[model samples]
Target: MDVVVLIGRILFALLFLGSGFGHLTQTDAMAAYTASKGVPAAKAGVLVSGVMLIVGGLSVLLGVWADLGSLILLVFVLPAAFLMHAFWKESDAQAKQGEMVHFNKDVALGGAALMLFAFFAHNSDLGLTITGPLFHLG
Candidate 1:
């Protein structure tokens, strides 16, 4: 793999890795935030999302089953964009702008996940994988 790809993967994985750790360690705070967004069983949601983020982040970072990992990330990100960052529902200008930024960031992350999924979908000539591609659509 190119050094750039490795670096990008590390950088991308760090975002989720840190957030996932935070979710588990600060469950109370994260659950409160999720509950504020009207998520039912907010604590459960936080815990589930936390595990998902950690698993996916590790998979991508390690380039093992990256296709599946990217799909997991895509699944997590798309819904989160709508469910948590519904900027259109915000009335206050500041809140709306804040939500919009988060929403856009999630959307962009989703897109990146898709790109990674495609890159890993075709064959197992992966530059960095040990036992990979594992499962893909192509």
Candidate 2:
């Protein structure tokens, strides 16, 4: 069970970790794309989000302060889902479909992060325990 948990954590964190690396490495491209989406302070947003994703992903993967990591993910994901993947605002069928898919994916990931936060908040033994003082609920 513990091994399964660790594996799951690694798999789950991979997306954010990879994305963070991309955001940092491809700052100009990412910022330009974000700016096209009308996101203000695109460059800064990319950098901040990149750092958040890296920290959050690492925390969860390492089984240390996962609750806080989950919170960080939730913060980054919710706004990102709405701002970046606004499917409702798209008119073209193909573009709308793609945006919808991305939106759904972000929403699903956000839900997973929320669930992780709840689980860790309860101090459940099903997987990793929250070791960070800030995230400790008890």
Model 2's alpha-carbon lDDT is 0.88
RMSD of every prediction: 1.2, 1.9
lDDT of 2 by residue, 96-116 (tens): 999999999999999999988
In candidate 2, what residue range of length 10 has the lowest lDDT sum? Answer: 126-135
lDDT of 1 at 97: 100
Per-model TM-score versus the true fold: 0.95, 0.92
**Residue 41: error of model 2 in Å?**
0.4
Q: Of the candidates shown, which would achieve the greatest lDDT relative to the real structure?
A: 1
Give the lowest summed-lDDT range of ten residues in model 1.
Answer: 129-138
TM-score (C-alpha) between model 1 and the true structure: 0.95
Residue by residue across 77-128, what tens digits does model 1's lDDT show? 9999999999999999999999999999999999999999888887657776
Cα lDDT of candidate 1 equals 0.89
* Candidate 2 vs. true structure, TM-score: 0.92
Give the runs in model 1 whose Cα sits over 4 Å from its true position: none
